[model samples]
Target chain A: MTPAVLIEKLQKRYGTVEAVKDVSFQIEPGEIFGLLGPNGAGKTTTLRCLCTLTEPDSGRIEVSGISVTEQPRLARQRLGYVAQEIALDKVLTGRELLQLQAALYHLPRAVISDRIESVLSLLGLQDYADKKTGTYSGGLKKRLDLAAGLLHQPDVLVLDEPTVGLDIESRLAVWDFLRRLREQGTTVLLTSHYLEEVDVLADRVAIIDQGVVIACGKPSELKDRVGGDRITLRIREFAPLEEAEKAKSLLQTIPTVQEVIINSSQGNSLNLVVSPQSDALLTVQKVLQEAGLPTFGIAQSRPSLDDVYLAATGRTLLDAEIAAAGTRDEKAERKKSMR
Target chain B: MSSTMTSTKASLNGKVAVAQTPSSANPVGDFFQETIALTRRLFIQLQRRPSTLIAGIIQPLMWLILFGALFQNAPQGLFGDNVNYGQFLGAGVIVFTAFGGALNAGLPVMFDREFGFLNRLLVAPLSSRYSIVAASAIFITAMSLIQTAAIVAMSAFLGAGLPDALGLGLVALIVLLLVVGVTALSLGLAFSLPGHIELIAVIFVTNLPLLFASTALVPLAFMPIWLQWVATLNPLSYAIEPIRYIYLHDNWSLNSIVMQAPWGQVTLGTALLILLSFAAAVLLSIQPRLRRSLA
Candidate 1:
């Protein structure tokens, strides 16, 4: 079967700035494919190109089988986009907004009402349907936005930063809603900076950084590919250099421990890379106790997507986001998103 | 909490909407449906937050009442007719109000663009993105009509007698032509301008100068030779002069002289043709800009 979405060597630039460069991916049907990256990492730009809101500088983007660039109207029929910022007309009631959306999509008159009703209930927005969107809380607005996007029953629902400013409860609700969407067999493509959000909700993810895809795979597979479990042990809070080195040496002797480094920035904590699924935390505690070094804290876990990002990009996602934050031009970014 | 609130009924029910086969497509019907639906959205907005429309109608009444009082006792035939100052100012107010309304037609679209609502419309598979333009034009025209009726009634009550039925129809046509033309230009700017601030700045600078340069407040004979040339060149004069003639003449025709310019007499037929050409020129000039943005 043809992929639900196929983006090949996608490139887009705004004046002197290259927003999406050499990015490509294919999403299969009925799977939640996530584009994971920090802000300004080309995720929104790639989605804009895919949604036919912006013309790509170069490359191919197809929705199912239709070329989005050449047949945007047809592609648009199959793609429902919910933008990051809620775009509700505050003067319009939610139901009225959905009716307008249905009409815009040219859904048949017979089914528009049913579709609106079903989506409102499905997103748990039935109670708020008659209220003007201006009165809704942030979470309700997002729910209503989701309802509008799903009203026409698109083949792929594309969301940008679905839960960027939503509270934890609303975020979890969105996550659950996405899972149910997958259960009902709709292809979902979303871009998010929240690592756990992607790991918890996405079936397959592509981590994009600085206009390029650094890693792409199942979350667990990407984590495993980056190698080994991590164990962070502090012999004592703010341990001296000699004690940290001693703890690192002691931990390094374990057969399951692959590597150990003293993290000087975090009070000389020892970071260990152990073979996957090993009980290295227990072993490290015993080793430090035997050496008369007090164990203030110790923990071990499987490598996370952050580790995969670190292995691929030499910096964590958080660090990249902070770096991007300092340089983000809100005005230019808004202009690029519109028109 | 949300997961337990409902099952996935949305997908189950969406089959009905999706079963709409591509083979059953109707492009013309789609265009009308989208246009009417989009137009309905603007009206709905007006109904809910009526401050704009309320102010739109009320401001023209203020102009009709206050401006009438401002020059209540000008010399007889000062505005170049057996008509009083209020009679001539009636047409001016009608055309000027519609012109003002139409010139600001792009502000809402600019807001939609800034708020990302335009992207919502753009991303949808409409019959054509021109529906966006069509919707704004229809909404603004309807709004201008309401204002025109209010001004016409106010002028008639103030002793500026109503025109014949055909003459009133001509008045509407004139107002519509001007509104449509100015609306096209405004929407063109909406798409080309970067943001609402820039668009508002352009509207602010364009509004009053065009009004003063036209015969809205004074006849061409009252101006210096330089200003007379400028007023004849202004399109608002083309819209205003014919309506003013229809209001004053009991027997009017397409060839009846409406205004005698420094160069030549502008007949009713020529003025209507000029307004038509102005509308057509604006529609054509804005096409590329609309295509680049909406396409």
Candidate 2:
């Protein structure tokens, strides 16, 4: 059989903004795949195209070998989309909404009740099933949304930023629920800007940036591919530019150091990428001491996904997030999302 | 490499559930199943939050009583031959109330779109998304009928005089056709407009204007030449004239002249045909918008 979801040469444009450009990925059945990107980084756009909410200007999207463009109804049948914003009729009880969902998916009457009960129980929503969703807390609403998405037992469950705006407890519950879903052999695809969320839950992740897939692989493999350990050495708490430059120049002479970047944002701290070794830190400290540079603080660790993002994009994820946030026109985006 | 493992895993899971047919057992059966399911949702909303429905019925009754009292002292025979202004206004109230309620049929859908609830529906394996539109139409039509009954009773109590049973039945047919047409236009607006705010603004702008321009509050002969022209041309007048004719004339027939438009006279049967055509036209006009938005 074909992969659970296959998207090839996906390209979409909104006005002059190329929201998703040349995005392609195959999700193996039963694996949790993550599309990772900061805000405005085309993650949601990709999900929208996959879920058939928006048509791609050019691309092919397939779910279970069915072309979504040509046979959207069939593809939609195979896909369950959980949007970032949980939408539930405030007046209706949770059970009522689920009943509606059962109908929309056309579940057989004989099994609809059993399926609703099972899914509600699976999501721990049995106690709150009779209450109006308007009274539900953020976590309860999300759980209800999850229950709605899974009501049909779709072949692939697609979630867009599922845990955003959720509290820590609710976030953990969502994560646990997703893990249980994966264990049951459902293909899961989710998008998130949170590095750790993707790191922990996703079996494979694609890092999208500027409407392109910059890197994709197992989290550890991507981290390893970036190579080496990162060492952040500060000459002083507020090092002078000259002092930071001197330390950076001194560190450059070390053969173990492959790359050195001065982080001016953090009081001129030196960020060094050094080949993995047991003695790299000691070697750096000794060199700094001989150079009369006092070490205010230093940390060394294996490269993380953030480090991979930094190495590949030349900017940290945090920086990209801030930039993306500033440039995003929320009003315009909300309008675009309406239809 | 992992592909082989996935296939094995999928088959393994498939065995646990024998009837692992991805497609429904029968698509034809599933279509009705889902359509009913979707329609049931709209009804549940009405059951739980009956406020809109309550207000829908009450507002028209209020218009009948308040407008009737306002015009109680009007000169006798001012409305038309052998009918009080209150009775003349009754048909207008019944038609206007249903028309106003139907005009708002799109608000819920607009809210759904803004809240991203529509995205949830679109993502589902719906037989056709038109089921969403159809569900709205069904719900609104039901509400219109209830309001129409309430208005009919209130009008008779106010001594506006009751139409005979057949006359009341004809009034319902007129209300249903008008509601169907207006509801379709409203739903089309809901899909076409960018947000609920815009939809409300359109509803706000269109609501009272349609009422005032039609024969809802005044007789066509009572208006200025231009206003008379507007009243005659208004679709609401097409609906109002037939229902008004049935209320005043016990021995009504299709050939009876129901309305004296500025341009010409419209017979009772011709008025029904016009309302039917209006409903069909509105439904057909919105098809492209629905196709693009729902597609």
TM-score of chain B of each: 0.94, 0.91
Worst 10 residues of 2 chain A by lDDT: A105-114
Model 2's CAPRI class?
Answer: acceptable
| Candidate 1 structure, TM-score to reference | 0.92
Model 1: colliding residue pairs: none
Question: What lDDT score is found at residue A28 in candidate 2?
Answer: 96
The 10-residue segment of model 1 chain B with minimum total lDDT is B1-10
Q: lDDT tens string, model 2, A85-194?
A: 99999888999999888777766577677778888888888999999999999999999998888877788999999999999999999999899888888999999999
Predictions in order: lDDT: 0.89, 0.86
Best by DockQ: 1
The per-candidate count of clashes, in order, stands at 0, 0
lDDT digits (tens) for residues B108-223 of candidate 2:
89988889988988887777778888888888888888888888888888888888888888888989999999999999999888888888899999999999999888888889
Estimate candidate 1's alpha-carbon lDDT, on a 0 to 1 scale.
Answer: 0.89
C-alpha DockQ for predicted model 2: 0.47
Kindly list the per-residue Cα lDDT of model 1 for residues B1-295, writing each as its tens digit: 1122211223544452244423256778889999999999999999988999999999998998899989889888787658788888999999999999999999999999999999899999889899999999999999999999999999999999999888899999999999999999999999899998999999999999999988999888889999999999999999999998888888999999998999999999999999999999999999988888998
